[model samples]
Target: MMYPPIHLPIVKVTVLEDRALVERHAEVVLSPGAQLVRVEGLSPLAVDRSLQAQLTGGSVAQARLHRAWKQKPREGSPEGKTEPRRRVDTLEAEWKRAQVDVQRLQSRVEVVNAAREDVLRAIAEFAGAGEARPESWHEQLEAVRASTTAAEEALRQARQHAERTRQRLVEAQAALAQGEQPEPLLVTTAELQVEHPTGGSVSLRLTYLVPCAVWRPAYRATLASTGGGESVTLECEAVVWQRTEEEWKDVELLLSTARPTLGAAPPRLVEDWLRLRDKSEQEKHTVDVAVREEVIQKTGEGGAHQTEELPGLDDGGEALTLTARHRVTLPSNGAPHRVPLFAFTAPAVSEFVGHPEHSPLVHRVARFDNRGPAVLLAGPVELVRASGYVGRAQLKFTGVGERLALGFGSEDTLRIVRQADVKYDTQRLTGRRTRTHLVKLFLSHTGERPVRVAIEERMPVSEVEAVEVKLLEEQTRPPPTKVSEEGILRFELAAPPRSQQELTLAYAVASSAKVSGL
Candidate 1:
């Protein structure tokens, strides 16, 4: 075990898988009503471990948020590229580190709460876990009370550390949201302009923004002022938002009139603000805003007209319409007026695949090779067979990555389906041999309501490759209140009868990668 299991009077938690035991105990045992913040070291690990796994799946995964300690743009290191790092990888590592902190703080919280519970049980005259007289219970409670103080102090310090890290993360996030400069989210094709204050509205081309408000880019302002009549410097951190998804993805935004403070180290005119932080923005004037990144994205439900099981075929086809809305607050009007931008269509997945030469997000070489084994497919069931070599078989992959290659599709779907790709790391690169029992399923749907091809892992049998697959769960229609993803097709009505969705299941495993017999 990498860490110890946590125990508390209020919460006794045992670690499950990669989850932190203390946080689990708090949720299941202590039952704290207060909502735990999801920041690093705050939220429980169990919430999104699957998604976190995919973000950090690669062997070379790691996120590097530039620190002040890193020197100024030496020679080749422009805007901190001084070293460029993989983002999704870093986010995954950050999430893992955050989970560890969460476990630590939660451990302290659980211990303290358990001690508090002891005091209550003592005062309320309730029985302790083990038999104890009222006087004995009181003494036990005193002992617990003494320990609680130290636990409280420990929790406070841990929280302080987490908060400082959070501040840095926030600043980084904020800067990324700006979507400015070399860290380009989209390939810039045209020039644009932004209306500014003092200088009034000047020329700055619209480098990026969509017809669909999945990402509405707006010019931001950062003001710095001193009490005395000191020169008030100006800075702006761009903000990009998705109106439909109600999300703010991290995109680099341009920084104008930004400079480091006199006493600050590593002075650079511009820096990447991937997260938000408390910066010098006391006295600043309102500047004009530019919005873009909306596109019409229409999705088609049901499946292909055919029912033949095809390898790697997606039945939930979609259409995307790109459009943008502009809400401008001029010097004259207190209320900002809104206007609609033009509309365009994004490429469908099939189209993107068909036209690999044009599609921006997908790599041609990224293909699924079913060389391992086959998955079982019976009726509506799909599952991978059990393997003795590695204990369990699972896989995780991404149809796309974080940046906006943006021909079409919702980032939400990517977060949901492509985000959580979990496959067992059973196959060691060394000479050791292992078996992976995976199933391959081919599906085609031609129904009003898109169907879910439910899949489960089959347990191993004592003899040969024999295994039985189980029907775990199916998602025909997502919850009405669910956060709808653009990549997934939604069915407003119930699943119709007699509609067929063809499916073929294939399973595979890693028998041996080396030639030991030779």
Candidate 2:
């Protein structure tokens, strides 16, 4: 036996990076024995292979996705009329009536004008023929003058009515053109076959995946200083965009970073072969060297730099699933809607960071550990403090227990000035060239409270045997507190209020004559 299609309401939705999984539930009464059931009102973008159905009191024998073109009622159709359709119909009727009124009033004005012209012509003819006495001619002319005035008044009123009717017609036309559009004719539904020995009322759940739905991670960080201590509050959220043609109202929402499009099989491996060749006479006599900027690679939790062949969801790291804290309602429009996921507060260490070589302004930095349950994905963060919203920053992928730092806004009371001096020399006997650089940074504080600043500087690193680089420690004043192998120099300084401090750094880069560029 065949049964009518049942309308299922969406109860839950799990949105991923590129798609969404929708779950719907409904209860219906059915007769005994096997019967074919159909569920209607699904998105056309739903995947065929992802359809799944479950029956509580019965068993589902077979389920499949079905697509068909169902025509919708047009405007003014006898079947039915939507609200927007009704509005359009009413406006159209009004416009027609207004057009008729304008034409009628215009005809009246033309008739009145013609009658006045005829009366004036008759009066002029009678006076020219000298057919009446002076008193009679005067009386006739006076009567004609009064009749002409009345005709002109009638014409004016007719023109005014016509103009007002025309304005209403124009307004009606504009509103009709700007009315809301109706839904498309294409529809998707799911068909299922079920069997039950004694069926009465049963609850069913239908789940499927749909495309054109995506979500991305976003964050809001607020830094505040309380009487007890300073803390940073991080709120995690998801920005979802979907056009599934089905509204999710008061449904449980889940945001996941899993990429279902990725395959499980490992990539095919290939063999690597190396070839060597002897150098020519010129290559043996001289060595070539060039200076180029190095690209920095980020290390993962394993403390090793890794690269991916294709970009995955959430910075190409592990997958994470987060549930919304409260129920959400999202429309079918393809617009971004932010949904709150979770939030956490942690103790923060606030400081001022300066990079004089790059910018003269010092920025306030806050360092905190990720004490939340899930890893923080890389996304844009909105920065807020006690003074309200300051600016925005980008947060990188941070794992649990990992420390992360964010720069809020620039410090207005602190100022920095940088200067550099360079000197070059060549030794004729050794055929060697040397370049010396002297860098100076001047810091000033205008605030009443003292503040500590961390200054960062970079030095060149030699990658070839013909070039060498070293920091001239003996000539440099107040050496850097920490120096990494990657040629990063860090200095920590404490500045008193209303005071100025100067720092100097000197470095040398020596290269042999065989080197091409320095």
Per-model TM-score, in order, reads: 0.17, 0.81
In candidate 2, which residue pairs clash? none
lDDT of 2 at 18: 85
**lDDT tens digits, residues 230-249, model 1?**
12111111122212111111
C-alpha local distance difference test of each model: 0.27, 0.83
Lowest lDDT 10-residue stretch of candidate 1: 410-419
Model 2 over residues 137-178: C-alpha lDDT tens digits?
567667667766766675566667656666765665566567
Task: Return model 1's CA RMSD, one decimal.
Answer: 35.4
Off by over 4 Å in 2: 74-148, 156-184, 264-272, 281-289, 299-312, 463-466, 512-517
